[model samples]
Target: MSRHIDLAVIGAGPAGARAALEAAHRGLSVTLLDEQPKPGGQVWRAKSAAILDAPPTPETEAGNRLRQSVQDSRVTHLGEARVWQIERAEDGWKLHVLRDGRSSPLRARALVIATGAREFVQPVPGWSTPGVLGLAGATALFKQDLALPGQRTIVSGTGPLVFFVAAEIRRLGGAVAAVITPNSRGDWLRVLPGMLQRPDLLARGVSWVADLMLAGVPIHWRHAVSAVDGGSAVEAVSFRKLGADWTPTGEARRMSADSLCLGNGLIPTVEAAQLAGVELEHCPELGGWVPRHGEDGTTGVPGLFLCGDGAGIRGAAAAEIHGRLAGLSAAQHLGADTRAERARLHPGYVRAARFGMAMTALSTPRAGLAQLTTEDTIVCRCESLTRAAIAAEIAGGANSTNAVKSGLRAGMGACGGKFCQTAVARMIAKAEGRAESDVPPPTARPPLRPVPVAALAGDFDYFDLPIPRPAPL
Candidate 1:
């Protein structure tokens, strides 16, 4: 038996939650799916029982409100369900969902994808060490298991996340050995136009700055992490004065720490969109390749919609607006009048988007970041493929991402290239002597995620699966 829904939403993040609420209110049978066991996505990740419950931050407050709405609106919340394949169907879509090692087919009249985003890390030497963690990864450990990465940690990277990560470590009584960022105080001035308009963000920034200063936590701006030290675990971190060219200039400084928490920025998650044949373009301002979408989250596909960071790299607030718009648009498609609701969200969307553009301007990763990879630096976490190996492939006429993957097997890992494709694509661009945007990301294949053989044994047959035709743009 196939489960049928009027609307099938992928992801339980701010976007998908709001989308589900919107459609459900319009009297649609909605099923909201997420791979996580809980409702909140990354931004509002639900904590485990062992951890001391955190008081609701603004993010959690808003997230809980929307999540509560979804729960009360008769929307089906499918937690711990992963959709690995989506094929064209007679009605709308046939989604292959895997849960607890069993695969089932779901038929949906409409689809909403809000897969969210992940941290973008610079590949530096020794990052493969056990204690090294991405900024978001560290947050997940703290939130999910109430676990700390190390007793002593160094938080380094760009973007506002560096500030938050450092504060969290300090709050946990973990020694924040140092905080480093490539952007300097002067860089803040460069994006003043955008920051000035966002007074709410400004006030919060002031509070965080004061608290960190009062706690005696040293913040080293205009500095970038040059390397991570120690054999099996992070023992030290090396830094150099930030330069326009990303060269290790002046005296290199070292800080001792058991763990390195680092992330420069975030990249949108668009695997689901790409697998559905939605068009994507590389936009550095929006944190690399994002699905081409409209204000209402309309994509190239007629019945499929996109929202949140998966569509662009906007923050939580902006994502909320996008989600609502998408939900309302979806409702309108179902023959419900949503004129007033769309009107209400449009202004907030515009206002937040201005701030978002400024954020992009202020926190854009420097081009010099591409040079962070050295011969020994690991590019693919799954295969342990080295920069040298990828470069060797690129030099040998592997000018495209697919070519490099074919030769070096960098993206043929458990991650399916999500963890490494950006860096690998950049390496290809550098080797091919072309622009980063020119080297396109590798194509995505079905089994978008790993699946169990038992899950597909009697319920599904790959050979019987029909090819999905692209929807009209």
Candidate 2:
């Protein structure tokens, strides 16, 4: 039997949570689903540890309020629920979900996808080492568990996250060996107009930088991580100055470290949106590929809307407003008048989006990032496929991401294509002498994520299964 809902929001992040609250307040039956045990998503994830007694920052305060509201709301919250497949039904959408190792079906008359975003880490030598993790992953450690990556960690990457993580480590009594980035000071200068749109966010970024400087952390601009050294765990990190095109220019300098926190920036997590039949377009400014939708989160598909970072790369501030607009639009689609609600949210959404986009553009990885990987560097960690191996497939007529996958099984790992698709597509574009956009991402398939066969088996028996008759001979 399928559980039916008036509105079903995927992802209980800032966007999805807000959307659910809005719809429920409007008298719609709503359900909010997420893989995490809480509703704040990554930006506002609920802290798990109580021993640290970490001081409250603006982010934590806002996140706490959001989570509290959701907890007090009438919307049904389903944590640890994973949607394996989604497709259209007679009146709306049907979702095949796996929860507590059991498969169930849910049908929603309206849907809002606020799946959010993931970090982009361009491959570098020794990046797969044990002590190396992305900036976002490092933040999550301290944010949730009050844990540190190591005593002395080297934070290397682009975007504001690099600085934020460095400061976080210092606050946690961990040593930051150094901070390195490929973006130059001029790159940030060029995006100042957008950053000015949100003075509060800009000030927050400045505070992070100030804290890093006060801690005597050396900030290296126009530089990129060349390699992480140590046989099994990170012992040191090497970096070199970058040219105008972001290519390595100066001699490589080494820094002693116990671990490396690296990230290029963020890319929208569009798998759910794509599976929901939402159209996507590559926008470098908004963080790689994002769903195409109106300001109100209305997409070409009726009753199926998109919001938050999943729709684009806007930060949590914009995501909250975007969620409200999406919820209002979704309600309107269900025949409720939401003009006043939509009108109130549109301005804040636009302004926050402007600032977030500026930061995203400044942090976007450059083409030269592809050169960081040597021929033998591992690009696909699960398959253990090296850069040279993937290039060989491309040289042999593997034109698209799917074609390369078909040849080398690059995306056949447990991760699906989340980690390596962008890098693989970059390799294809470089080898084919074409733009990266020319190489579309691999086609999305059902069971969006891997699931146990037994969980999907449900209440069925082989003995009772209908058997097909043999063909006439």
Candidate 3:
């Protein structure tokens, strides 16, 4: 008696939300499933009604519009449903879902994966401590729950997210000890001329950095956090200077702070796609191994598409455009739209995707990251693999992440390899003298979120609902 949907979008982030709303508007029945309790993915993580009712900030208002648009009767919002797998059935695909200690299945004519991405953490000394958190985690605590992790916080790492986190912390009336960025001001200068092609975006980026400077938040360029010092929680951090190649020069210094927020970058959550048999490729510029997606979000599998960070790490704007293109493509495949409609949407999608590609290429992880690790540093907290162990594995002819993982069991942890995979891949790549993109990532399986077997057994009919059939001809 499982319910059937015309389109089942397996994420409620910007991409999935846009796809669901667009598909529903085009006279298709849509079901939106998200692991979280609300619609907004990590980027827009706020309470559903709470966000809608709040006096609109410019940021909140845009989300408000999108939220209101997706509230139509044709859309069924299934919050808290964790999809374990997507298997190709005789007709379309079957999605096995687990919800609240129960299991159920649903069939959909088409599927759009917008599972999004997660923050990439490079293991450093004391990274696993209680007070130490990822940049995104800190943002989530402040934005969603209006809670601060500590009174004083040091946000470190590279990329635009570091600045965003610092702004949020300062906005929340928390003391920002410093914004430590590994990228030098010269790095920004090198990318600035190219960024000038989009004056508006350049202006916005400059304004963000300028605001931080005006607020007296010390911006440390060419510096990286080497270690976090604390017993049960983070109390201070050690930083080292990077040379021209981005390697730490032997010089180091320390700063006292209550919390250490670190993030190297983000990687696409491709578990669902991989489980569905989607082909993956290692694109260092776009995180690690991401699914090979076409320009219009179509995967090699028919009726299956990827959009947003799940496809690769593009910002929210690009994710939205990709979602719309995927929805249009799905509609065309379903005979819901004409050829002309598809043709019209194609050009806009291309332009946005090109912009995303350029941004991704320029901001890709630098080579200097490998120099951050020390022999005593833990590589995998879950498996207790030390840097020495990984180095030994690489020296012993393990050239890829899988081989290194099998040799040292670095990624076989409770978190399902999320934390250790990137670091392991990078280490293997460096040892073998291969491009980071040459190292294949581990196979992604399900259940996407770890569920206790007890919970699965208790709720056998969790995903069960009456199936809806079309009217007879």
Off by over 4 Å in 3: 48-56, 193-201, 354-363, 458-473
Clashes of each: 0, 0, 2
Error of 1 at 255 (Å): 1.1
Residue 461, candidate 2: C-alpha displacement in angstroms: 5.9
Error (Å) of candidate 3 at residue 205 is 3.0
Pairs clashing in candidate 3?
A: 102-459, 104-463
List, residue by residue over 1-473, the lDDT tens digit for candidate 3. 18877888999888888888777878898888998887778877754444444444444555556666766447888889988878997778899888877778899999889989888877778888788889889878765666677888888977777887887777767888988887777766766654555566667767768888999989888788888999988889999887877678876789999898898878888888998889998876666678989756788998888888888876677788778777777776677763565577667666555555545544467787666778878878888888898888889888877787777777677877888888888887777788876777787666677777866576356459677898899
* Residue 258 displacement (Å), model 2: 0.8
For candidate 2, lDDT tens digit of each residue in 411-456?
8789887889999998988988998778878888877888999888
Per-model CA lDDT versus the true structure: 0.82, 0.88, 0.78
- Kindly give the stretch of ten consecutive residues in candidate 1 with the minimal lDDT sum: 51-60
Q: Summing lDDT over every window of 10 consecutive residues in candidate 2, give the lowest-scoring window.
A: 51-60
Each model's RMSD to truth, in Å?
Answer: 6.3, 2.7, 7.1
Candidate 3 at 379: error in angstroms? Answer: 1.9
